[model samples]
Target: MTQTTPTTPVPPGALDGTGESSKGEATDNRARSRAAGPGRLLAIVLTGQLMAVLDVFIVNVAAPTLRADLHASGSGLQLVVAGYTISYAVLLITGARLGALIGHRQAFLAGLTVFTAASLACGLAPGTGALIAFRFIQGAGAAVMLPQVLSLIQRTFTGASRAQALGAYSAVLASGAAAGQVLGGVLVQADLFGTGWRPVFLVNVPIGLVLLILGPRWLGGAEERPESRAGGGAAGRSGALDLAGLLLLAAAVLLFTVPMVLGQEWGWPLWGWVMLGLSAVLAAVFAVYEARLAGRGGAPLISPRVAGAPGMPLAIARIVLAMAANAGFLFVMTLHVQGALGYGALRAGWTFAPTAVAFGLVGLNWRRIPARWQPVTVPSGFLLAAVSFAGVGLALRDGSDGGPWLFAALVGVGTGLSFAYSPVLTRTLATIRPQDAADASGVLVTSAQLGMLTGVAVFGAIFLGHGPGVDASADALWATCLALAGAALCGAIVGLVIRVGHLR
Candidate 1:
């Protein structure tokens, strides 16, 4: 038997099953400290991410059932859906930073524990209010847990291994959204044990419990203090929480996301616009304050170095664009099929499966494209997505079902989006220093969450605002598709202008 100890360094790729470096031989020292190895580590982290992202869309299909059983108010029903989104968005930046202070593994487990418990509460709640409250806690837990997935990948993988890791990460991120709808619909429709919509929330309980058990072992000893390095100042390496910045971030994110979440539901109330404006002001103030705090040698909530990293601004802009377009496409398609075509939840949910499958396939395999053509992949993806969305709009012009062509179009859209985003995310993190990866992950996740909300609000409004008629709905969906295509085109132009991977 081989000797192993806390101080013993593991060989690169030793625990990855093949006993060979993936693509490139480069390895991170931090990763070499792994007790359970990178393969298990990646599995653990992605499992957490799957659980978090799955809940994001799972409740959409179950809402009506839940409302009827609980006799929920309109706003309460919205909260059941949007409550998770709001808390998840508002707390992301803080969650990202939490891993830096506590050990990443500890933070991850703590958050997972919270999420699992909240999910149980949500499943068993006696009233809509309790479910809503539990959903917020669940979202808060997700917000805390999700960022660590990105950060752990950044810190633990290098070279070709890192690329593949990010690919799988991208697959999970995109596929989980559609998967949520499908799973939710199946669970609700099946009504196993005659539990109505409870199973949708309860399904996570067992999964979460399993993950919590495996996390502490495979995630290394994040609860234990990180070992000190050669010199001094190991403590400084683990940053502290800046409560002021945390509060400001929470306030800004809440103010913005709440309005975007509820505005259309409330018929675009005036107070929503007021909140939007206030959000902008608060965000600006937060920026100025954080910058000042960083200048003073204090631990800023968002480190200036991470935010101002080379090519970061443009990279973030592309993320926002990609996510917003993706969200808008999904939102519009769901509404178009269900609201107009009058499909049941399960049927409507199945409509999204093709997109999810195509995205996963492309996400996992996109790297197989020849090196010579790799540079054009992102722009090309954007272009494909743009054309696909345009085609969808044209097909829907007459207010009739687009037939099998609709599924093919969805496949194209998903493939295009996978190309547009997964590589960009990989390239963006690759450019940042590993030490700053946590902070960078925070910025990225926050941007993506906000973009999703923005997409649904802006694009949903365009589809919804047109009023209730077959012709009107068809025209509105067409317009919405055009807008989505336009957004993709803009991203394509940006990708062409700035090669994210090549940014120095």
Candidate 2:
């Protein structure tokens, strides 16, 4: 059998291949620069991601303090949280487009500047309204920067290094979720500088400043190669920003997101249902409109050919389902442990330590696992997660204390590696052309954000509606567990189907 070479040209020094010496020498120099500075580059980008993700869960621990300190009413408090999420979710795709239009490095720097400045504003806000507004700005800033993380990784790294970079992204996400809560609890308890919950927002200021100063120099010109800047490889080459598509898509996302964020808080009001229904209709319209634009040889927000790829739909579904389960379960568990079980914020946060540890370890070594095992690994991991979730529910019901939760957390760690993200992401993007990387990454992240929001809303509703009882918390935990189990089952089926059909 003859060996087949990759059609996508490997960047110079990307592989030890037969080639001209002068070109190889130039590529080698570029590769050396990348190797020497990649750590710093990765640091700046990953830190941005960590901060963005941290903001998502960090505020939960500070909510009561914010309410009291800012004189925030119940609705005001909801807005404080929801504002960040809504803006982040709605503008993520737009942000990705902006990165493609200008450059990832420029976009990232701009975003970081906005985020850091907004963070400072958040820390200093004297009222709930101001805080909410600042948080929204912060979210928009995060949206503008987060997509660049993946884009830069795609551009700057290749082969195993790229795989490792992706693994680190997954690890940071897992740790940030748990660490945000833990750090928030600790900071609130410390009340350092007599600032109460202000430290949480203020903390990003210094880090952001450091990154802002060093990011430009370290990231350098790697992100602005002529091909990337020209058309972003493939997707960006099409046409001007699809303003109409952007508007419709943004409206649809906002409509869908607002209800998910606020419906549980407002007891699922009629207007919320209306918004949800309208969102679906708008989504359909957006799809039709995008398809028309693509057919007309115009730039569409989502390329039909890309979205129609064999495993793309299932992969997206897996993302939404998995994120929904993870987000919803975490939300309910936080309430159950703190409210019903009388656990303090710090204690509640520590319960997830096992998950972070497991996730970190697996992420660090994910490349050791062969690519072919992905299909089997993912479904197996989901099944394992289902078992752990069931154990958590059972533990809650039996009043078996913390031991069971720890075991469950540990067992659930595999899911973070194989189920929560890495495998599915690798598979989904495996066949995508490099030019479309930004669009594809944006789609993936947006689906994840929506899944998380929906999980919080749908599962929050279930937990909130539980009537007073001796085991009300347990009942809620069980319900959340069942939902997670169902999600895991769906994910497993998708994986198995893909394997059986040889779709990958």
Candidate 3:
């Protein structure tokens, strides 16, 4: 919550440190002046932020519809939904580095342009394969644009203004997520001029275009690259890209993700198991290589300092698990309500609104609690999530709606997850020094994306792996919910360890 102070105000021409510095600085200052107020800057940042976050969940509501229209296989439908996350998670660190290298404002706008174009492509896709490809591109755009948001806030605002801006960031996250569900449903049900599921994606086009126009007008260039001023290590290799690290990380995720996603449709083939096993080995290799890179004074893809900060890994793990379980629960419920129960898309979408609202409420207000009690909330939240997940499974087991109990369980799960995630993330970032903010942000964001990706792939597999039949699907969901509950318990255990170490 403390303001990052490394962003000393740049006198005109200081940012470029070049022969034509005056022109660049004048241009930068003029842009900054136009969007001078924190309100204007945050408006631009949060709108892009909302669009990026909303895309992740919006597809969930449209999944069943996509399947019907595209004639997508079960795995294909999952691909349509998850392919964006795959590329997004894998490329996020690279995207952060890219933003740092080529000016944050430019990166954001370029990325937004790519995202908008890809959304249009997704809307117009002729087949499932094409749609899946476009989704990956869309995710890439998000990865590029999103990391700059916090950087911009850190640069443009100070003190109380910065804190409020950060609050707005959090609010947008909650609003975007909840709004995505309801909006996706409404758009689908209305069929938007009979466009069917396409509108869920097409909706981004106009908004993206508006942001694209406003982005250049509103956003100012600061020390978008924290390394330039904060620390010496990152400065040493300002232009370096970690090719080896990118390869290893991508391979590891792909090995694990591809198998988990396709194994169900592929009948749990031997190759899938082999790939899954290999992923662990690659992950270990990635870790070792990154430590060596950082130790050699190179800019590693992920900073070990940020990741290995006191009590940081444990705190981050709790969030990663919490995210996985949270995403998994949403995916499974969508499957149940839309696929098995035959609920309309709008009705099914409404079912998730309570969870999103509850999560937003808890996340936004947890700070009001006494500081002393905050540590326990992490573990306690996970424990609550476990119970809520169990209740949801029990409620959903019979084909009929679990009625009020279902909604209540959803609300409880949302609250539990908000407590588990939001506080831990704030504390986790607090562990990093200002110079390392971008890397720290990259580590946390990449991990969160990875968690969501894992949840969708693994939980989707667990739910759909069972042979066909409503009874079979329902039984699979119960088992998946139990599995998710176990994951939350693990998160709780991790949180307790963090507390025992006095790492709050």
Top lDDT model = 1
Write candidate 2's Cα lDDT for 1-504 as tens digits.
111122334334332211221232335434744653777788889999999988998888788788889889988999998899999999999988887777778888999999999999999998998999999999999999998887776556555565677778777765677678778888887888889989989999999999988887888664553224434333355545788988999999999999889888887899999999999999999999988887887778776646864467767877787777777777887788777777765677777667666766676675566645543666666777777777677777754454756566545743543444665665455445445667877898899899989888887887778866438877877787777777777766765555545534
Which residue pairs does candidate 1 place in steric collision?
A: none
Candidate 3 residue-wise lDDT, 127-246, digit = tens: 999999999999999989887776565445543344445545655664466668878998899998878999999999999999888777677544454456444224325556677887
User: Which candidate leads in TM-score?
Assistant: 1
Candidate 2 global CA lDDT score: 0.74
lDDT of each: 0.79, 0.74, 0.73
Off by over 4 Å in 2: 1-36, 222-235, 370-372, 410-420, 496-504
Q: Which segments of candidate 1 are over 4 A away from where they belong?
A: 1-34, 223-239, 495-504
Assess the local accuracy of residue 236 in candidate 3 as a C-alpha lDDT between 0 and 100.
24
TM-score of structure candidate 1: 0.90
Total clashes in model 2, counting residue pairs 3 or more apart in sequence or in different chains: 2
Model 1, range 1-504, lDDT digits (tens) per residue?
A: 110111223344332212232323234334453555889999988988998998999998888789999999999999999999999999898887777666567888889999999999999999988999999999999999998888778667766777789899989987788888888878888989999999998998999999988877888755332211211111234334677878887898899999999998998889999999999999999999988876776767776656755556666777788789888777787777778888777887888898889888988988788766666777788889998898888777798888877867888988998988887777666655555656887899888888889989999988887888778888998999999999988887774355434444
